[model samples]
Target: MKIRVSDLISRKERSKKIDYKFEIPKFEFEGDVITPVSKCEVSGVITSDKDIVIMKAKVTCTLEMNCSRCLDTFIYPIDIDIEERFANNNSLENEDVIIVLDDILDIAQVVESNIISSLPIQRLCKSDCKGLCQECGANLNKESCSCNNDDVDIRFDVLKGFFDNKEV
Candidate 1:
């Protein structure tokens, strides 16, 4: 995706309707692999106001990701709303607006960036997902393991024997 904004810049078209579907490869983010399972669909409008071009679009896609706790593969649906500003002329300030190069708006990078930003920091399959057990490497959500999890410090052994003799 690249869209030509010359029509808007030339004042021939006030707005441009964009409807496109594209594919993206797997992305490595935060030590996790995000694989796109569906085509990314972007639908929105680009409007020109004076020398500034504004693009508002909704991006949608399904991604295959792993659960952070248990490392199980799962599908993660993503929907991102993007609003970007571009400057067609040199008179506008360059800090906030992306400068249009050769009258084209390359939206691939923008869409990809939005998708990456929208991902959750911690991906979970469920709210109460029981992760894997540390002792027997068992999936806690599936089965229980007889692993002794009560850890006591060696420095408290003298106190433990003293407390065991007291009835209170």
Candidate 2:
């Protein structure tokens, strides 16, 4: 959501608190589109200290994603704390700080960044997912397969013969 901070920038008040709710549509990342299962809410206070504006917010949302192991779809809840600093002056050399432009603060970019960064590296449907069987492409978590475990590929039989001829 784009918030116009012109009032906050011009006002004499040093600090202000604002609450916001937004519906973030599905966003694509790494060729995968993730959609939110519920509305996202953010509440925070903006404090001005000299020429710097500090914004602290808490964001909450539920998103739908596919499991990395089993490729199953599931819901994931996110609750993260966001802290950002905006500088009213341009002479600051810190690259981490955001520069306010036209007295506007577009919080949608911030929210998206936080949500993406907070996501787990590997998404799993369950804690102990057995994954798909390599032999017959069966789901190991569902049932047992008929493929034999002791069977070896015929291409490697020459190596097996060397082991059988060993004295040991």
Candidate 3:
């Protein structure tokens, strides 16, 4: 995931093509594990303008993730476009710029960070997932349940009591 940029910095090369494929280890986010099912593929180019180096790349990968609703495993595919800036001097250090050290750029962190941020907060197996029944702990998407789910909110208890005390 590291690329040599001495030629670009020295004005010897205007741009360099990048194509790499690598594996990523499983990592945990919140309480779920995100495991990569395929090799991460990155393809793009890095160009130099004055003292600044810009990298634009497209990354693709598939991950095994659990649905937050039904807790079922599903394949989550990712296709992201990334653009990053780098400089040889520390003066360019900021939110959008990375300082390249030792004439080499290590892009593994950048790629992983982009992938993690792109994940959905609530992963669902389908767009209309039925989730599970809170009363009987049964999967509503699979079968029907007889458990009573008519419970009312505690804030309405006073109204319920007033109606219960009335006589017809």
Q: Which candidate is the best by TM-score?
A: 3
In terms of lDDT, the best-performing candidate is: 3
Instruction: Please provide, for model 2 over 1-168, each residue's C-alpha lDDT reduced to its tens digit, 9 standing for 90 to 100.
Output: 665655666678877775888888898766667889998888898887766778899999999988776677789999999998887567753756787766677877778888998888888778998777778877787888987766678898778878678895
Ranking by lDDT: 3, 1, 2
Which pairs of residues collide in model 2?
A: none
Across 38-92, the per-residue lDDT of candidate 3 in tens digits comes to 9999999989887788999999999999989978888999999999888887776
* Model 2 ranges with Cα > 4 A deviation: 93-95, 148-168
Q: Give the range of the ten consecutive residues with the poorest summed lDDT in model 1.
A: 87-96
TM agreement with the true structure for every prediction: 0.84, 0.81, 0.86
Q: How well is each residue in 66-89 modelled by candidate 1, as lDDT tens digits?
A: 988888888999988999998766
Model 3's number of clashes is: 0
Greater-TM-score candidate between 2 and 3 = 3
Arrange candidates, best TM-score first.
Answer: 3, 1, 2
